[model samples]
Target: MSGLPDILLAAVTGFGCALFFSSIPVGPINLTIINEGSQRGFKWAWFIGFGASIMEAIYCALSFTGFSSFFGNPGVKAVMEVLTFVFLLFLGAKFLFVQSVNLPATPLRAAAEKIEARLEQKLHPRSAFLIGFVRVMGNLGVFLFWIVLTGNFMSHDWVADALWPKAACVGGVALGTNAWFFALCFAVSRGHGRFSEATLLRLQRLSGVCLLVVGLFDGTHIVWQLARHRMALTS
Candidate 1:
């Protein structure tokens, strides 16, 4: 409506964009969540998403609220890049070497029965939340990602400059991200029985390999660029 406040419009639209971005099937974290949901129930899945959403909100706020410039510093950038690289490598190794999550995909009713029969292996609430938080944080440099995302929105005139609207947009990012994650969890929870343990293990290893390759390439590129920049400055 024409009567809609500019900030509200930006926030709403920005939220849609963030939701789409979060749903993009790129990251290991999403795969992990799906696997978790497919094995555990929806409660476990949602808790993981909740933790991830919190971090996503924090970063979105930082990027949109002028803290992005602070992270753009060379030292900070380097540190984030290095940490991401190391974490990705370690995660990949863990995926390759550790016992994969191989829970049998029983029907929801059956899963509940089994849980009553014994302890459930699905991530519990506290574990899921903390794990999700740690997993999201491992994908460092998301601050720059949000900055670029918001900058593009501004460039395209899809966003407003006012403070409240910007905050709203950032909140939307978290909401959108959480929404997508919840949707993913819902889908997985419904079909958890369809996934065989072999299938789950294969997917896990595949995602791990993908993460490793992405980290190696991206991490090295960042290091190379930093080195070149330093050499140029010194020369």
Candidate 2:
């Protein structure tokens, strides 16, 4: 493929990966930041997204370097699957048990408001950059997903040889994934606001249920897979 076409294709693939994955329950950190930014301001959101993109880039680079293979061993995969399952289950249980809405007057809400107020006070470029950095660091699942996607892309023969192309592909995907944050910020900042706090809360609740279902399904699948592997070994 020509460079332009190749870059475009890479960008599409990157965008697709981000869009699909972001729809998943665990993938909503970017969305959360975006929404928060909409409520707070774009500058804050921009830094958060930028920081997340940087971490994603680092993970993609590492994945490209074959670092994820360390976790590809059957034993390691099994362990990871188990841990992931447990974590998801825990998250689901917590969602089911906890109160779904936060009152603005609640201490937790107050604390959050204070934090945002502080962030607003420090809303310089440097502070925005720091916020972005910190937000990305806090989002571990997104990092892991980026690593996996990078590993998969690196394994492909068509585009593997060209470092620039590969980097572009990764960058394209990161941008696509983080695009939601920017959009949300822009929308909220525009003041043509479509989503209310109630709407956001409802969506969050629905997302939590979806996460719960996915966790149960994945956990069951892992158990079945482990059983089959054991049976094959014995047979």
Candidate 3:
């Protein structure tokens, strides 16, 4: 069908969005998911990634359908942004505080030992699914990103005429976006044995800091947007 290309393009867009968002500061959740899945199998990694993609699809749908507008209210957005920033700052501090000397013994080289000990026990399938679900839900960065993308699409002049096609494109983007995170986790986890534990810990810390920075930036942006909206309304 001629519509297929549109759908594929949409999927690629979604993938790119997800990749860009996830590539930023890594976090325990993503890293853990990757490491766990790597320990288990690539299929599990794929499943987790797929599950995350589905969540993104739901959010995208909500944004496109105008349901996201309820939360998009200037006041609400401002509050959420502040909360996200504070959360990130707190996480960053925690990462900075965690001493690396407390890890258990492992055959992995010192570089890898740190990470192996930091890794939580293997995650069950149900747990992984739930984690994937929660991660998507709590990930304000990704949520806002999709919301913006969907909003832009909806505002277009052709939105009404090409509703179905546009929707398909958004869905595709969601799938593509999520695939990257899942793939990363699977790949790293599979090869974790080859890396030093210390290297793993360092990676985790780096990811934590990255998330914190993103959270701060998002929070500030939301606040500024709210202020501008207030000024305009009063004027």
Candidate 4:
């Protein structure tokens, strides 16, 4: 393949890969979006996703530029896994322990909520964008994910070793990531109103527990791998 056809094919592959992977089971990024959407509404949540999409594109481009080896290095990969474990564990605990504001209605509660609304209003899109950026940066999984994906595409000769095709694919990744985030934010915002305050609180706690479970699983896997590696070395 050459010219526009090659570019188009690579772009489509990148788009499909980004969308499919991003839409997979609950992870830090999506969980944060869901939590924030419930609390602040669609705009805040969407901004976060937008920031993440930008980072996704950057990471995709990095993959084409051969940064994948850095991420794949055993030492670097181990540190990233450890950091990801800690990050997930921290978020899980934060969400689990943190109290939801919209409790059962009381006269004073209205005033309290008004103050909170004012505060949330002060949270500009820039702040939300930064939060999204920082959140993804902390996760490390996003970089590793792109590493594996880009490698697969290259190995299969799906994307050529050329500038334009790679750039087009990176652009497609941004679009695909944003598309999923938009749909998720829209759905969550639309359904948010239907939920009672108490229900929302429950949902928050449930998401927290799920995050904790995922973190624990990741930590366990890391430990298992380390143990096996040590045994092999000693043997």
Question: Candidate 2 on 37-139: residue-level lDDT in tens?
Answer: 6576777766666666666666666665565455545565556566666766665665444453442244644554565456546664356656665444544
TM values, all candidates: 0.56, 0.55, 0.49, 0.58
CA deviation > 4 Å runs, candidate 4: 67-126, 193-235
Candidate 3 or 2, higher lDDT: 2
Q: Order the numbered candidates by lDDT, best leading.
A: 4, 1, 2, 3
Error of 2 at 114 (Å): 15
**lDDT (Cα, 0-100) at 204 in candidate 4:** 62
Number of clashing residue pairs, candidate 1 = 0
Residues 1-235, model 1: lDDT tens digits: 2224867777786688677656644454577777788788888988888788887888777676784454445565556556666766776676655465633333643544454334323533348887776555545445556765665455334556556667777778878888988887887899883656566667667756865886688577776887999999999
Ranked by TM-score from best down, the candidates are 4, 1, 2, 3
Whole-model lDDT values for every prediction: 0.66, 0.58, 0.56, 0.72
1-235, model 3: which lDDT tens digit per residue? 3365655555565556456555533443455555666587666666666666677777777666664454445555445456556766776666545556233343434434343343323333355665565556555555555665554333322122245655766666566656676667656666752545576567657756776776677666666877998999999
Q: Which residue runs of candidate 1 sit more than 4 Å off their true CA positions? A: 1-4, 67-126, 193-235
Q: Clashes in each model (backbone N, CA, C under 3 Å)? A: 0, 2, 21, 0
Query: Of the candidates shown, which would achieve the greatest TM-score relative to the real structure?
Result: 4
What tens digits encode model 4's per-residue C-alpha lDDT throughout 1-235? 3699989988998888687656642455677787888889999999999888898888889877985445545576676667767866776686666576333454554554464355445643247887776556544556766775676566445677788888888988999999999988997798883545465566566656866887798789789988999999999
Best by lDDT: 4
* Model 3: residues with Cα > 4 Å off, grouped in runs: 1-12, 25-29, 67-127, 138-141, 153-161, 193-235
